[model samples]
Target: GFLSGRQENVLRDLRRQMTQAAEELRFERAARLRDQIMAVEQVLERQKVISARMVDQDVIAFVREDGSAAVQMFYIRGGKLIGQNHFVLEGAGEDADACEAVQEFVKQYYQTAAEIPQEVLLPCDIAEASIVQAWLRSRRGSKVEITVPVRGDKRRLVEMAQENALHALEQMRAEMRARLSNADRALRELAEALRLPEPPRRIECYDISNFQSEAFVGSMVVCENGEMAKSEYRRFRIRMHQDHPDDPRMIREVVSRRLSAGLEGEARFTKMPDLILVDGGQGQVSAAAAALDELGLAIPVCGLAKRFELLILPDEPEPVALPRNSQALYLVQRIRDEAHRFANAYRILLQGKKQTRSALLEVPGIGPTRARALIRKFGSVARMREATLEELAECPGMNRKAAEALYQYFRDAEVREEA
Candidate 1:
């Protein structure tokens, strides 16, 4: 998808490797390579097949506007030629439309092609079969064909095609092995970059969001194998105290409460993550560390500082800078962003509720008890307005007179201020 020269370079390398595999008698590898090439060709051929079928013709060839010629023929989905019988003949005379005839031919042809058995057909043409058989015979001829009539270049071509298929198969297997190895290597590099105790199997990150202790909330997100473990995530509402607004205390309380509750709860944090990350500098890390220490959890903790692209280690004087393109860095960014997103959403929800509560609670007659009763009964002030006086009186400590007064007060108040 880059420069044409780069694309050409890659194609040349692939061709060279394919040729080398074939020469080395690595039939399985060569077959795999051939299959890839065939699959790619099949994808390109989809347009041809679709257009040809729609046009109702056996497309012999087409020249693109760039003057590139492409030949088309019917084939089984498995890449085998469907044979000449696939074509149908139509039109009776000189004006007998050849194009219509070709189209008619292809329609019937494809139907038959779909019914072909999933095996190599015995090449009835001896010339074609013989060419392939001879080439196989040169190597292990007797082991090659059991059904086909064995000839000249056609026979050799068959043998070559078989060889290519076998090589492609081997290449596919080798490619898989190499891919697994590269993945392992990349994982190890990430582990080293993060100074993780081991290649992180799972990680948990925490972030706090608030507007000056109003609507304060914390969010925790989990990642497994460098991907989001959203199902395992948790969120917390800040309830301790608003005066100090200490983040360290907030984080500690969140972790402590979450872990403590997880001990016996359904949504338990029983599976400890390999690492822990906080979306702040050292102070957040220190808070998390203390909480984990108290809990006797030994997971390593670190921080992703917002100011710089540095990973803050516990008790370290300087944070470590990881390469911008590093997978390790990406993983940390994912965790931090997820935590921040969750925390921000939770905070917003709290803010919305707080604003609603402040407006209702500011009513002269509505103290905390009455406001809580109204919220609990009607869920919100808007809902309370829709309620009948009887429903309002149903609320604890709310008499009919008070309920009517409240309803009237709300109706008359203009620009009710939020807390």
Candidate 2:
């Protein structure tokens, strides 16, 4: 009774410590303490006053579902459960021998573990039971026994472990199936809204970003089967009509370049999208359609207007208004937002490069060649600002005097900004 009371007190203290650890945001420490608390609780639950003898033991049970197997171990000390652990085995054959698997697990587990119990209980008898028992006895410095309980408290414990393993496997399978089902439903809804023959497995969205007529860039974001495919995304630096950059011209150039790459069988752009969405109103839709027409392609193109969240199609007389809560509309909005973000990111990168180049050129001694070298070496203006004078001097095409000038320029700029 004293031992049981002491164990309860330790469990209560561990629970309090775990709670405090979680409150302080020490998650790793909290997790370890939580495990200790669980082990203590399990031991208390398995306590049996009928068995006066205090003996340490382990009960192991095995269950298989599909091609996966779960082996659960319940650790008992002084006739009380101390803890439990489970191992999941993938590609374990459906008709594999459970006894042999359990035997192998026991051998491997006991080899590394410091503690070896006086007894081990299994649902089925292991082949080398005596040999394992001897090995365990040698480690424990006392006699060890291994048995398969027929119908007793030990057998009931084994059954419970097996049930737990099966339940865990079922939960995993349910979660996986639910994800696939949701993806399928979303794709179906998208297809029905767009009036396509089937779901658009590969969808691409485009957006253009620029400041006045400078640093014009377009981004193409890909989504396959209701999921964003970041690897397939492409960015283009608008080349045509650079002097007068407009949304229609930028959309046209991006779409044409992308279609040409696909036609030329570029590995990344070889797969044509089932649908193309442009981030604009009617003008963008018409521009994209004309680009595809020039290439003799018949891909479906639509435009999404941000103001009223309207969908504009090339052939439709008016824009289509989707339900506010529709899944299809949500998917379209996500794609459009991602495209805008990607394009804006490219624009910012180019603007930063321009500013860095201008700043370098403003310094009296640095010209185009030295400015390009510095930009290449430093990667960005922020990095150049943080660089030491010695590092700047060590860069190619830079000497002590030039390095000091470059460093002083950034320092002065910082002071000016602060002022």
What would the TM-scores of all predictions be?
0.51, 0.59
Top-TM-score candidate index: 2
Query: What are the lDDT figures for the candidates, one per model?
Result: 0.61, 0.84
lDDT of 1 at 389: 74
* Residue 42 in model 1: lDDT: 54
- Runs of candidate 2 with Cα error greater than 4 angstroms are 1-176, 242-245, 385-404, 407-419
Worst 10 residues of 1 by lDDT: 61-70
lDDT for each residue of candidate 1 in 1-419, tens digit (9 for 90 to 100): 12343644555666677665544334356568756655544544443322122211221211111211111333323333332211112232344443343334323443444332222222232334455445444443244342332555334434444444344445445655544443344446557976765687777888888886577788989877644677998898878856556888888888777766756564667776677788888888899889888988777888899888688888889888888665566557767888999999988877776677788776666777787778877877778878877888789978777787787776776336432
- Cα lDDT over the full model 2: 0.84
Among residues 3 or more apart in sequence or in different chains, the pairs in candidate 2 whose N, CA or C atoms overlap within 3 Å are: 43-81
RMSD of each: 18.4, 11.2
Off by over 4 Å in 1: 1-189, 239-242, 263-267, 387-398, 413-419
